[model samples]
Target: MKLPKELVNGSIIFIGITAYFLLMVILGYGNSFYLRLVNIFFVFYGVNRTIQMNVKEGQTDFVSNAVSTMVTSLIGVFLSIIGLVIYSYMQGGDDYVQSLSETFLFGGNPSIFIYSVSLLFEGIASSVIVTMLLMLYWNNRLTAD
Candidate 1:
């Protein structure tokens, strides 16, 4: 059975993010700025591909396109977060958890549950933002005839 275009696009995004993370680990720069910056490109690529796939599949309605973009972003974010959690556990969870707490949740250490919840919210926000930006571009293209 063929996968839906949305799933295909999401998988692409997830794979790209996971590959980047692995690359960072290999290069011993897992938490570096440069590697993180590369993730922006992955997001853009995912959104672009989502648009292309939706159009190709004759699902060019704005809502359909937007849904596809959102789905793609969600999958990317979910996979990225899961990968990070695994990396943290592998590298020893305490230091990783403490760093995250200091960096994001102020000083006091947060439980893993809290940290994961925060990550989920961040992912949702990312999904919405990417979807909105892509939809704006796509809308213009659609109207530019």
Candidate 2:
């Protein structure tokens, strides 16, 4: 087995992000069961790439890649949190509470006017988390070799 350091990292991040995305979709437990299919497909692609990638012997740039991936991902997370807070504040806690009670978190409550806004916030948060993790994995993996 030609254990090249760079290739291993690539595969981990590619697969990891796909897993994370699929998990969020699964947690939905609402109406999306095909999430796993997409994730698995991505995992396959990552695996294929890993197998094809050349893990040539050289100075493994793990440290730099790790730092870049971690730092930028942290920033993404921080910004997402801030955005969520601001969005929630705009909707007003009282209104949000009322909507939550009325719609039950599905974001579709004809009774509540704020469900759409809340759903948007949730989607944004989810996007941020997904992006952050994927970014970290990609950066690290790409630089490892």
lDDT of each: 0.77, 0.43
Error of 1 at 52 (Å): 0.4
Estimate TM-scores for all models: 0.84, 0.32
lDDT of residue 38 for candidate 1: 74
Q: Per-residue CA lDDT of candidate 1, range 40-117, in tens?
A: 678878878989877777777998788878888887788777876777788678677777566353467765556777
lDDT of candidate 2 over 32-126, digit per residue (tens): 43442343334334333332332232323544433433433333333433443454466574565454444353533333335445544654454
Error of 1 at 35 (Å): 3.8
lDDT (0-100) at residue 82 of candidate 1?
A: 80
| lDDT score of residue 103 within candidate 2 | 31
lDDT of 1: 0.77
lDDT of 2 at 64: 46
